[model samples]
Target: MPVSKKLPQLFYGGDYNPEQWPEDVWLEDMRLMKQAGVNIVSVGIFSWAILQPNAENYDFGWLDRLMNLLADNGIMADLATATASPPAWLAQLHPESLPVDENGVRFSHGSRQHYCPNSKAFRHYGQGLVRRLAHRYKDHPALAMWHVNNEYGCHVSRCYCAECTVRFREWLQQRYGTVQELNARWGTNFWSQKYYAWDEIALPAKTPTFANPGQQLDYMRFMSDSLLDAYLGEYRILKQITPDVPVMTNFMGAFKPLDEFEWAKHMDVVTWDSYPEPTAGIPVAAAMQHDLMRSLRGGQPFILMEQVTSQVNWRQRNPLKRPGVMRLWSYQAIARGSDGVMFFQWRQSRAGAEKFHGAMVTHTGDENGRVYREVAQLGNELKRLQALVDTRIEAKVAILFDWHNWWALELDSKPSRDVLFLEQIGHYYKALFDAGIAVDFVQPHADLNKYRLVIAPALYLIGPGVSDNLEAYVQQGGTLLTTFFSGIVDENDRIHLGGYPAPLRKLLGLCVEEFDPMLPDQTNGLRVRGQGDLDGDYKCTLWADIIRLEGAEALASFTADFFAGSPAVTAHTFGQGKAYYVGTHAEDAFVAGMLRRILSDLGVQPPVMTPLGVEVSERRAEGRSYIFLLNHLDQPAEVQLPAAGFTDLISGRKLQGSVRLSANEVLILHKDTEHAV
Candidate 1:
């Protein structure tokens, strides 16, 4: 219920739905929530069916009762428009609202995200329902922020219907302006794809002979825009009624179906669900997502809207999060920049697709379950650590992660098939994360000089303002790094043909003449030049861009290729700063070693207490700073505390200089002295 402009320290509680149960159950739920210190509940997420069963018939009897109960309990309701999925009656009556697939097949009801965003029937009914709900509950005392929709990627690529085609034509016109431009971008001249009029164009269909990647990429962009337009319409309508309430939509982390970065520009707040893969390197993946979400709002903290305390129901092999893993992961999000912590379902469901997903309270309604106990403990600890509210995490490292480049790289049919984008970015990210260096995952347009060291791996597509930003950053004494296939294409996916690397050639001081694409098993030798203590040779593979140094100095050279002895790694001094361009996909060891040396040179040092294999992150507020040290290892590890005396905020133990941490344990140290960057 704390709606202060300065966000409260811990965002307690989670999604609650009293409408799903009986009155007696609702009463008990409230009792348990208060005991657990639950302060907020995201209500009415999927209540569209109950709210509007029929077009002309609306019911708020149950919702009114639910709100009154929350108000009595002093719980803030994160009210939702319930417009993610419309009622079955709407789709049954107006079939056009149901989306058609790329294969020219229209979908049936029964699943969420079934409505076509471009369908007028769907837009009218959806916005009308939202308008009604906003007017009805705008003045409710229990209302917190507005959650516009649930996770937005349940529906795949949509809208090949007639209405969609018309809108798609309009979008294309706005983008390309003329058929000649469209033809050139899509390479229409190669296969007699010359379009005389806008009407002649069609979406990328899943036909046996007509699967064009460029066209499909554009279709993805269009679909994302279409959904964003729908979301914006609902948001504006709600804002018209409740202007002060923040509006957000739950986003699926690392979802490839939609461009969430573009969608984030219009939202009042950025929020996302975190469900990491159970693989060996999930921490890196999770960190990448957390940083990406923060970058969407220009480094502002986002809401960790949903994560399971234990096993989930959807994965084929559901594995429980090991002891202490949940706490560590939650702190990982907070250490990055998360303002709130929540889960999908407060209480486990008895029937539905997510019946088995872990919840705060199980179906048995027991308060002593393992998950419930963990939630209870976290709730208590959050109550004590109230100083972290609205605090910021500072970083000197910047890793440029662009959705446009990701999209473009995947669509590249000519590059080596093994050159996956996320995997490459993740390799660098893991190196930095393991080194305990705070990294900002950014888009091309982010502020450059805020970071001392900038790492841009696989920057395949450069946008309008990126080159200038990098140029400025380098001129202002910032270290810039980029890899192969960079500066090859502009925002429109058109080739920048003044040489291989367009505008960055001057900054990099290298001209790429030819590139060698190799299979996964193929290997190349990278020999270090200009002998030093770290001078040696290494193995590398995948696509290698052969370069000739114009003004830069070569650090490494190819050993056995036709272009042997050519510069594989070059460093160029722009003004007060420098740029390193790695023209090949180098080995992880070499990359880590090179980055370590570069970071050392740039004075990008982690805290003196930073340890290997452990995560060290710091967040600073007005009067104090919290240093989070987490042991992600399976075995116990010892840690060196800050030189100055400090206290463990989580454990209430005072310490002087050093400490030992158990496996998967986390320590939040409160430093008395302030260090502002």
Candidate 2:
């Protein structure tokens, strides 16, 4: 089933906290929302304290009236369970409900997510709240979808309290089944830390030096599973009552602590909050996040759950979005496989922690303000472009973005501190993005037959079945690209025995005996062979592998350092396909040049040729291809269209030749011969 079957059009509007406002103001809010074309609003996201004022007292009358008002105004509700935070009384009555910090200090109830995930009282109360809300709103006319506990693990991801320690032991017991297995898996014999019983295992906290690597890695896994357990507790209750409505919680894009891919499997719909800093000016990292979120559910379209309308309040010096930039970013999300565009709040707060956050209705409650006008215009545009809903973005290139690798690669002690996983992934993703090539992020074991090229950057941890998958893909005529520090360890962070990059050594046709890690100030050069974009010498940094070429030929060799004249880059012909290994972190120019050469050799082309600042993306649905061309520059730019004329769905303009797009403008194009405008 789709995320929201009842409301198929692009879900507009955002979080609406009517509980914070007076009854009269709520009526005005509804009127303004209707004027702004808002059809859905997420309510009661953090209203737990108000919903049940005291432990024994229940007060959902205000919410009941608010729901009725929303239904009467033709607005749907993405109803929240009000279990994101427990009432203050719960913490006051049971102190164990509060989370304890790494230093062993218990956190108070001032902030949200203050409760411990494994606390018995907190889970009992939170699940009870979900049960009550689900039963009451199971048949409500305004209910579109269920918004579970808000942003799980936004804070208090892991608690060092005694209760969590006990629960962590239980979790370990369930996983290992015996103490001997635990000892072997954790490699506890190295430090005389072998456990005699399950109770001996403790939370990794406040050690003199670094904790046991295996223990720490398992703790990370347990903590992620602990949060998932809390979510599942509420999910079970909601599904038992209202099985038809899809349940979702907003995910922070590229969040480090929790394993989002594992969480995505439990969620009925994948949604995330996007708050790119205005100073960055829509960096490639932000685009990568959109692609990552979309890839979480196997390339399904995700919802842009929360974005600020103008400025955010949390930053030190908040900067407003430049004119036309908000609209441009919204379309950017749509082009990247977002089915809905929403924001953090519907109305600006008069007084609260988020008073300065941008919203659709300002504190003055002016519906005709610039922010409201833009929101309304975008809402109208979504209505016009309803055909784009449920569409999928097809890509011939896939990039592997595994969180297990992310967690293990950044451990306390590794080969190099400067070896960052996302930075390496971004280097490759940015090159493809700048080349105007659309790409999809995939898990390590996902099917690779659909894409002609696959890029797995810094794949430090090779779990079970991943090696076989990559080998098969390469052997079956799929070009593969991997970088330094890949295939170095298993899921347990133990080194593969034979050599560096052990499992992939055969596929890559190279063996590394040692790693030449350089400091931040150090640099090396690579001498490229043959005549192309990669013909000249290029700068490399961070790491260089001491390579012994087995069967592959060197495309480039290090021109400096002790590993000079070694294979800095190698290519091997395996079966009908080729595998390339980059032995060092190179500059952006080198990465782009290498990508261009590979893509050219593979006969892969960009969707359209555009300028550097112009972004090109395509979505296909019902035998129609929708091409989005966005100009992200300060000045107007021109794009040459294909010979076959196309129609702009936004402006209903038919054009055959070159088209000029204004600064921060967007065009949704479809073949002119297919549809009449």
**Top model by TM-score, which number?**
2
| Regions of candidate 2 where Cα sits further than 4 Å from its true position | 675-677
lDDT tens digits, residues 1-677, model 2? 33687788888899998877889988788878887778899999999988887776677798889889989998999999888878889998999999898888999987788888899999888887788888888999999989988888887777899998998899888988999998887788887998998888789988888888888888889889999998899888888899889988899899888899999998888999999997686457878999999989988999999998899999999999987888899999999999888998988888878999999777777777788889888887787887888789888999998888898899898879899888898999999988988898899999999999999999999999999999999999999999999999888888888988899999999898888889989999999978466899999999999899989999999998677898999999998889999999999999999999889988888778899999999988767889999998889999999888898888888977999999999999899767532
lDDT of 1 by residue, 587-648 (tens): 88888888888888878877545567678888776666888888888877887775787777
Model 1, residue 398: C-alpha shift (Å):
1.3
lDDT, candidate 2, residue 290? 93
CA lDDT of each candidate? 0.81, 0.88
Candidate 1 wrongly placed segments (more than 4 Å): 1-7, 208-214, 278-282, 529-533, 673-677
